[model samples]
Target: MSATSFAIETRGVTRVFDSRKGFLFREVSRTEALKGVDLAVEQGAIFGLLGPNGAGKTTLTKILSTLLLPTGGRAFVLGHDVVTDAEWLRPRIGLVLGGERGLYNRISGRENLRYFADLYGLPTAERERRIEEILERVDLSSAADRRVEEYSRGMKQKLHLARGILHRPQVLFLDEPTIGLDPKSARETRKLVRSLVADGVTIFLTTHYMFEAEELCPQLAILSKGRIVARDTVARLRQLVGGDRTLEAEAYGFEDSEVSALRRLPGVSKIIEEEYGPRTRLTLRVRTDEIRPDDVRALLPDHPELEVKERRTSLEDVYLDLVEEEAH
Candidate 1:
């Protein structure tokens, strides 16, 4: 894609940390967080970086948001180079890192946002107006005056998000945004994200939650073993396994022993076991991506009491495919 079409771009970007000092409390050796990587995210799109822990998602987000520099290669946000034009790029992007130290604990949430607003140099009148708007958007209006130190983890996360958006940036980077939130709070955050995207803001999200990415982002890239294994819309990625493959099952007395048998079956790629309201359910990814009920049924004969159900391919399939490829 042309440079202008990309809200964020990176080419062969790499970052390494040297810890040769030997850590009794010190250091040890150089750790490579990101290997050669290339990416281009379109403007106004929620582009997800799907991966498990330590898979370079945060490193990529840090480089794009100007928190960390690449050890080699190039990275840019909104046409501005990360290293040389971080200042120019900074205001155009908002970052909501799912961690501590993003806000001032001594002050109220409103006070915290106002401080950041001033840092961005918003005028007196506009800063207050924007702060009020963001507080409402993040559902922190009721808690706006409470000291951040007293806020719950979810509240802190919301404040971090609010501070990032107060400047009304063109691109927003959210790294594990729902990391520590409760179910209700996480749902609220998802709603807030949808509202922001509807307002024309581009979001770059790094998350391990397959369902979250599946629900929120149409386009995504999976990072595994320090490289991007795949990049595509959720529907397109699901097509990798084909349309004829689905987990067809008959449920009666499903047991833990059934998982192993199911995995050994032809066309079954992965299996996830869960209990729902006292009923045991197994989620499986078929080797083929198509909807072939008979083949799936043919693979299971012992469980006549089993129920026939077809589970659709999701972001988890894409993630598992990447992980599986790495193992081979």
Candidate 2:
């Protein structure tokens, strides 16, 4: 696709932070928060950026939202440069960062919308109309008259969504929009995202929930450290494991020797073990064509007792593979 066909584009976008410490806070070190990252988001696609905590996802989002300047490279939103044309771009993009601070506790949700609508320069008549429409869209119409302090976490999150779309921005940046919500609320938020894309709004979503990205984003980019490790459709990325299938086992106990023994099994590529008090979970990647369920069963230690299951390769597997490769 041509550059103009994209709603958001970046070229070698880089950001560096000068870490300072001391009595006077002198510059002590430099950290490269974003290292020459590049992304091209289609005009009406829900593009997901997945990463671990401190993986530079929020930093990149901030840069694209025109809240911070990049140390190097360039970014454009809706065909307008984020740095040179921020005034034009800001009005066309919406930002919904995860938090409750953006709303005023003393004011009613309706009033908060009114205040933001005014900041966007919407006239009184149009502002009221838009506020009502957005409140209904986010399912906050019943609570619109109540003070923000009275709203639940999910309701507050919905309010954030309503505020983001109040001006009907062409591009929306959602930084962990469902971060603190319950499962039901998060699902609803995902549904709302799909509806907005259906209405022709491009979404740039940053999230740590692998399944959420798998369910919502047709395409995703996995960010690690300060760079993008992989970018493609979830299916294509899952193929990164070649023909390996994940083997998961839940057991009562595990020992270091048993783990070492499992690692020595033929066709086993990797193993990750987790313990939760008395229960333990083990995830293994094995060449499906070469290893059978019986093969895995025969190698298990007899005392611990384990239940084994074969699972399909998922986005999280692909993400870990890429990130681990980058680390090495």
Candidate 3:
């Protein structure tokens, strides 16, 4: 697709942070936060980015949102270059870096929204009206006049979101939007995200929640060790990890020779071993319908205590497989 068709795009985007340490602060230590990362997010779509802690998710989000510049390549938001056209992109884009730090603790939530609205250059005639609408949309109208320091974590998150979309941005960047929310609050936050999409907003979401990503994002990319390890729909990602069908077997232990035997079974593509207290669990990724849980059970007939189960491969499985591979 063309540049204008995508709300966010990156080419060979890289970021390296150099810090001085030790005596006289002469020692230079380098950390590569993003390495040759290339990505494209379609307009009006919710694109989820999944990664572990310190995996460059925040670094890339900062770059795309114009909060920080890349060290090596280019990034664009809504067809505008992040580095060269940052001023133009800022108003068209909204960001909720989700936390307690952004809001003013001394003032009321309504006052916080008013402050941000002024910064976004909202028309004075419509500023109060817009703030009220946003407060209602995020279900925070009743608490709008309350002090921010007294707000719950979830309430603060909603206010952060309220401030983000108050300017009616075309693209929104949400970094761990539901990180510390209670279950009910997280669900409500997700519902609000859907409503924003319905209003023609393209969202770039970076989250560690697998269920959230699966539920909200039709397309997702996994970033590991500062690189795009995989990018696709969850269904396609399952195939990449191995297959949808997964068989798990547990026993006290399995001989190395027995594991090799399981690997030779028809449709078995990958085997992961894990230890649970006294028992050892072997998870097999199977690609064919011909292989049944009983089929796997027959191989471990020697272990009378062996237990076998079958289930579908989930997004968490795909994420672990890809991220683990990158770690090696």
Which candidate number has the best TM-score?
Answer: 3
Which model, 1 or 2, shows the larger TM-score?
2
* Candidate achieving higher lDDT, 1 or 3: 3
Candidate 3 local accuracy as lDDT?
0.94
Using TM-score as the yardstick, the better of models 2 and 3 is 3
Taking all chains together, each candidate's TM-score versus the true structure is 0.83, 0.87, 0.97
- The deviation in Å at residue 243 for candidate 1 is 4.4
Tens digits of per-residue lDDT for model 2 on 71-179?
9998888877889888888878999996777889899999999988999988888998899899988899999999999999999999999989999999999999999
Q: Model 3, residue 46: displacement in angstroms?
A: 0.5
Candidate 3, 5-80: lDDT as tens digits = 5889999999999988888658998999999999999899999999999999999999999999899988888888
lDDT scores in order:
0.81, 0.87, 0.94
Candidate 2: regions farther than 4 A off: 1-3, 23-25, 242-244, 249-282, 286-291, 298-306
Q: Superposing every Cα of model 2 onto the true structure, what RMSD results?
A: 3.2
Which consecutive 10 residues in model 1 have the weakest lDDT in total? 241-250
Root-mean-square deviation of each candidate, in angstroms?
Answer: 4.7, 3.2, 1.4
